[model samples]
Target: MRSDLSRRRFLGGALALGATATLAACGYQEDTGGSGTSQAWSYTDDRGRKLGGDRPKRIVAQVTAAAALWEFGIRPVGIFGPSKLPNGEKDPLAGPIDLGKVQSLGNVWGEFNYDRYVSLEPDLLISVMYLRDELWYVPAEQAEAVEKAAPTLGVDLAGVSMPDGIEKFRTLAKALGADVNTPRINEAKATFERAGQNFADAAKTVNGKTALLVSATKEGMWAGNAQGFPSSKQMAEAGLTFLEPKAPGDGNYWEQLSWENAGKYRSDIILLDNRHGNLQSEQLKASYPTWRQLPAVRAGNVFAWNPETPFYYEAATEQLDRLGSSLRTV
Candidate 1:
């Protein structure tokens, strides 16, 4: 599921970057790059409604976006899933809302309760995706349903990876009343930009070498071919070469790569995307234990796939910013 999510972001980037560059480009440049205050923060829902007020007080956020809100002092009245909350959610607005008091809008792949949402009487309804990437993570119909109940603000953050996700988060923050256009935003942007540059520089030093992003699970193993996970795309974007597998058109971008075949790829780096499963969990520590057994792991070139952002919200941009910092440390 995580692999598919990244793939979606890369594939969608072609369209999203073009169609909403004006919006997406926010907090990414000095002077707002001529977008101006007219292009100020606002929620662009699935239905294309623009939602903003002088001060947005009541909010209903999706799980990931809800986390972003916590980062910026905006407490959501409700969220999509209970498990989406961070560790301290129960104690305060720092995490997920109280399950008993807050209604379970829906699961990661289900519909939200429209009637209950209306009862909650939120000023704005938000959609966040840090947990799941697929649109089905929360039924598309639910977005529309919530819109009907109130001023639903659906930030379709599905498949938004790393730095891009962080940019999206800043935009969401501004819409929710954070001073995203302030010097703080600029500092954050500078930090993230430097991180990307460092990643790019490192990739260049390893010039012309290829890398692979794969995950091991109890079920088995999954490897990204071309048109797959954004992690692979990210490495490629950072300037490292990739021996992309021939994935059939937009179908399943991922295909199984046996460990034997995996070694044959001759990748300079191996990014292991650990997951929950017997085989994958075991593989996490046991798959490549011996130093001389595998070259990349032996050379300390193997990297664990680290999630940079909250995968599911407006503050995803902040998460992306963190990605650069995290990857730099790695």
Candidate 2:
């Protein structure tokens, strides 16, 4: 059996904690200054696990979680996971996190440092759970020790529509004391709302069109199941057709295929995974003749897809708009 690594050959399947009453705040930002260190704070994660304390001020979240919180104006003190690239620049999945201000515990898979994590004296550790109750990026070997170090939280990012996933983060951001009611957040939310209808309308123009979303490795390809990912689920719900594999592989997230079988499913457009370390459409063309022969590739109907896009309204709006524009060209 193949090991279940989050990156490379293994697709990841994916958290919460503490003591106080569950906060009633939803997605909107309340007038709370977000500095409620004196007031008790509690939040129930997607796994139904609740953790709380004096509104966490020294939070440590996985890079993606940090990015989502940053969008809502709550900066985590420390972050782990794929926050930095080999180039040392911030990864797109990191959103606009100021690397200089935050400490990165690990930049690659299976690289979390226990000593570094505990040294931060974190009040809360939050990460996205791609699978039920499994916190992404927390090394399984060290999970027990890490969980004992601080209160933990997990935001479910899978098996839910994009809007629903984003709302989950939004509510967590609000509960954490983000200045969500400000004009900036309101404008962002308004723009994101408009993009939803725009995406649906654009889907109408590209009638009979289809898209295939895939992430590749030197060994093979993994075509994602639209229903398994948040963005794809939302796009499909908007009436855009995404090709699904007849048989899904690990985690029900994607179908594993050798390079020779990559053309099994053909589509009008191909949304290639654009996460750091993943091969781009151009690279795929250069590396494989099969990729070159695909109709989508020949027509250049390939687009970059950041599968782990942070749950920020503006970021989501941009993502939907870009995909919508691509759908029109098909």
Q: What Cα-based lDDT does every candidate model obtain?
A: 0.49, 0.78
Could you tell me every candidate's TM-score relative to the true structure?
0.62, 0.87
Question: What lDDT tens digits, residue by residue, belong to model 2 across residues 1-330?
Answer: 012254632244432322232222211112353655444666767766555547888889998788888888888988988876788777777887899999888887788888988889887889987767777778777776776777678887867887887777778989998877889888888999899999999999977989898888787888888888777888899998889989887777778788998899999888888886678887888889988888899998998877777778877899999988887887
Candidate 1 Cα misplacement greater than 4 A, ranges: 2-43, 46-56, 81-108, 111-119, 128-136, 140-144, 156-161, 182-185, 225-234, 248-253, 258-266, 275-295, 298-300, 311-330
Can you write out model 1's per-residue Cα lDDT over 63-83, one digit (the tens) per residue?
A: 656765554546777776433
Query: lDDT of candidate 1 vs native?
Result: 0.49
Worst 10 residues of 2 by lDDT: 21-30
Question: How far is 298's C-alpha from truth in model 1 (Å)?
Answer: 5.2
Best by lDDT: 2
Residue 73 deviation, candidate 1, in Å?
4.0
Give RMSD to native, each candidate.
Answer: 8.6, 5.7
Give the best candidate by TM-score: 2
RMSD of 2: 5.7
